[model samples]
Target: MKKTTETLRGNYFFKQDELIYVNRNDENFVGPFHDHDFLEIAYIVEGEGFHHIGESVQKVRKGELFYLPIGISHVFRPKSTSGQKLVVINCLFSPNLLPKLIAFASEKPTVDFLWRMRDGLLSNYSVRDRNDRFERLFQSMFEQYSTRAPGCEDMLHALLFQLMVELHRSMRESENTDQSLPKEAAFQDLLHYLRNNCEQELTLSHLAHLSGFSERHLQRLFHQHTGQSWFKYWQSVRVRRSSELLLRTSDKIQHIAEAVGYKDIHSFNAVFKRLTGLTPSQYRKRE
Candidate 1:
């Protein structure tokens, strides 16, 4: 079997104490499944391709950048059509190469998310330079590293740090854009629970325990998010489900009331009338 995980010759890419940089231009290159000891940042500068990261294959296009954590097996399969070529810029650096940038990010509110990406919790953490911000940064760094001009090392570090900050900013922006309300998964799950278990005895304590939140906090969130008190919202849900049962089933009023968490017919009738402006019998008769 062909050996997987092509261990890179570190000295060939890096000069002395400098980091590794590569501007790969290939017409039909199929890089082997491999990994590096240091973190790798690969940017597609031209053409499109498929990246085999671990067990998953993701399509990559021009102006896209991917951050690969150390020792994660991956390979590049560049696509070509009508003599077109794929161009990629690879930036490989030691763990300590970005100390200042990492330290600055550690002090930010998105520190947990940054750690998630670094720890490979996101697995395939990638961002497309849709606006060409990262694209230009990579281009400038590649030129400096390839040419080895005077003060090129300093210039490269500056560009690399800028890209690092932009990457963190972009990731946070994307996350914020995707999650507009900042609601926790448990809160959403609670809504799902309420929808399915409207007939069950659900109390503030039970919901707070289920969501791992304080009763007062959960109650505040419930009313703030839905614009209704917990009891009122749950009563509305029970009433809605009861309306459906009334139309679709021949169950009696007392049984229906009990089935929808109402042990007393009078209480159920009063709530139903308050919400729907009609008694269960009247609703059933009309439908």
Candidate 2:
């Protein structure tokens, strides 16, 4: 049986309040050339097929993720009608959210990806999800779209952000050295540095110098990934490290405070109590 590939516009597909559509589909054969008014991310879940995008036809297997920007006509054709079934998960979202995506994206590749779409410069491209990480995230968005729970819209948007960032990371890992994002290396390195070096009195100015970002930009970067301000993130890291010391080591509370970068016991006790709702000594007692 032949399949139809005439996808209707946004109004025909999306629901009210929740404007995204997600479905796991089976493709039987090649369909007519069709374009969409919205953006799409298609994850091939099972079987093999060929994707006809723009002027290219690429052999696509399971774990291949494709990006289809608006107005890009494309179709999927299964390799054979009698072979293993071709399963795909298609996620369609409105173009209205692209502005927000461009605004909140902290890295270059992501902004580059969205800009390519905005300027009509993007050709459809596919990436391989070697780790099955994308499969899990796609499943999550599928479930969230299905359930439509409280804050479902916000959750799906957040998950979409996660998916894009993951796509960027996978791209970086797959790129040759010359094709990499040079100075704007993923903010992941700086995040790890902060988590690993909580003992130092790390300042925003210092971190900004290291990351080649303005102090304000670095603060926004911190909030983007850690959901906390610079001072709060550093404080939380310090407090959490102190908790581990409190539980694992025989160090005195005053020494633990100093070890985690606090100059005095009083300040450490204040932050620890506020964060844990227990004084350091009381927390130790509970354990």
Candidate 3:
């Protein structure tokens, strides 16, 4: 079948020799499913909606931020039943900005993570707009775009980079907060983290780092508590999440699989069947 996706051109959106573009829109006006030639940072300003990205139509509400890579097909549709229309602030730029960021930034972990973001080492990410500071920063970028003041292009570029640094800071602070668990957390705290973040890419090595446990120790703990290896335990968590999505939403099988962190639909099918003794399709039909 021919693809129905619309393609957005960078030249059309980024004018005046600008490195960044900023816009705010009421997403209630549903638009064509489209991919673009540049990176995009879209933040929900208010209200609620569904974001159609990849194969998922995930419900999103106010304070959500998404970093979309080039060629990622997506669109926003405001909730039909909501009193308030969904609003979003979008910041767009080419992935080519990475080199400049690298040249200007210090060798900090935050900077390193931003590189991963542009390099596709990390998957698309979304977070709550809990930081008022970021909202103000985004608003400043919008104003800078509309005013076209002297040096506005440079100003917009700086503001965009500032947002990236602040994002890493906020998220790191959040992680530190999560890590405040007592050391004697006895894998309980780490287990809870795995359950809550099953959608994330957490490997045994990473989990060991998070818990200050040796990888071998983590293996033993998993076997003791769950009668499974570390990978098997996490797999069960993801499969359980997949089952919940299957029963609770009308999303496609592929969408459900991705939502649970399975990139390959075939792998998802095999695992779901192995654990539940029913294919995802059959499981859904049984309910």
Candidate 4:
């Protein structure tokens, strides 16, 4: 029989009423592959090790914070060198632990993180602590959990809230810097507009005007951020979307081509074949 999440709770020594608390400091510990019902926020307090999540193993050093959603089989393997210890502060909690009022009142970023995790979008997400504040936040939360003073639960909630806000900001900044331009709100809006308006006639001048930037400036940023010319990037997006429509809908090839901004069937077939190495008909047949 597959182990349920409640089994993990029993191993972690969770009391009946306490669903959220920090794990005790582990020294030179090797964990077994396990899946759990609750979500886990793991902060490496000290030492270095390998984090095995599903089929991938990532080197985890001190100052890395990772959030593992429910039911991901994972384990931490301590480095074999002598005197090396791996300590992690794991905050485990059920989805129902957080009040609905908190989710409703939280900032958009915080709410976004919650919803993404709930919707199974942010699996195996890890962010290094660049500002060194995340470790401190975990330490403070662990201390509060240990103390159990009056209003400790509220304090834990506040600390977790701050951690979530910081994590969301860090993840956004990391995404912006990862092989892409600083995709702040404006850039995201531009992408959204492009995807929605892919069927329409697209031009650099039109995009530049819509973006409220000069054509030269928009072209420069677009190339620098995406490592592609605006026209090429737009074409790539259109072709990718066309592939989705090809397999998902019974739309005719000419209509699909027109919907993806290509009025000419030959032009669409050429571009799609170049990118996907298969004609649309061939790709759909395989699917």
The top-ranked prediction according to TM-score is: 3
Please, what are the lDDT tens digits per residue for candidate 3 over residues 142-215? 99999989998778777887888877765665567565334434476677788778668888899988888999
Q: Write the per-residue lDDT of candidate 4 for residues 1-287, one digit (tens) a residue.
A: 44222226534645666657676566454455777877788999889888877777889889888888877888877876577878889888776654542554447667767767666687678987754668778889988989889998778888877777777777777666554434344565676688778899989999887877688977887787688888888988999899999999999999999988888999999999998999999999997
- In the range 144-219, model 1's lDDT, one tens digit per residue, is 9889899987787778777877777767666785563334545766776887786688899988888778989888
List the candidates' TM-scores in order: 0.54, 0.56, 0.57, 0.56
Assess each prediction's global lDDT (C-alpha) against the native. 0.76, 0.80, 0.82, 0.78
User: Clashing residue pairs, candidate 2?
Assistant: none
Q: Candidate 2's residue-wise lDDT over 1-287, tens digit each? A: 33344765887788774467888888876457788888889999999988887676889999999988887778877888777777899988886776677887887879987676666675566887744678989999889888979987888888887887887676666564763354345466676677778778788888988778898988887787789998998899889999999999888998999888989788899999999999999988898
By lDDT, the best candidate is 3
Residue pairs clashing in model 4 are none
TM-score of 4: 0.56
Q: Would you list the rank order by TM-score, best first?
A: 3, 2, 4, 1
Ranking by lDDT: 3, 2, 4, 1
Which TM-score value belongs to model 2? 0.56
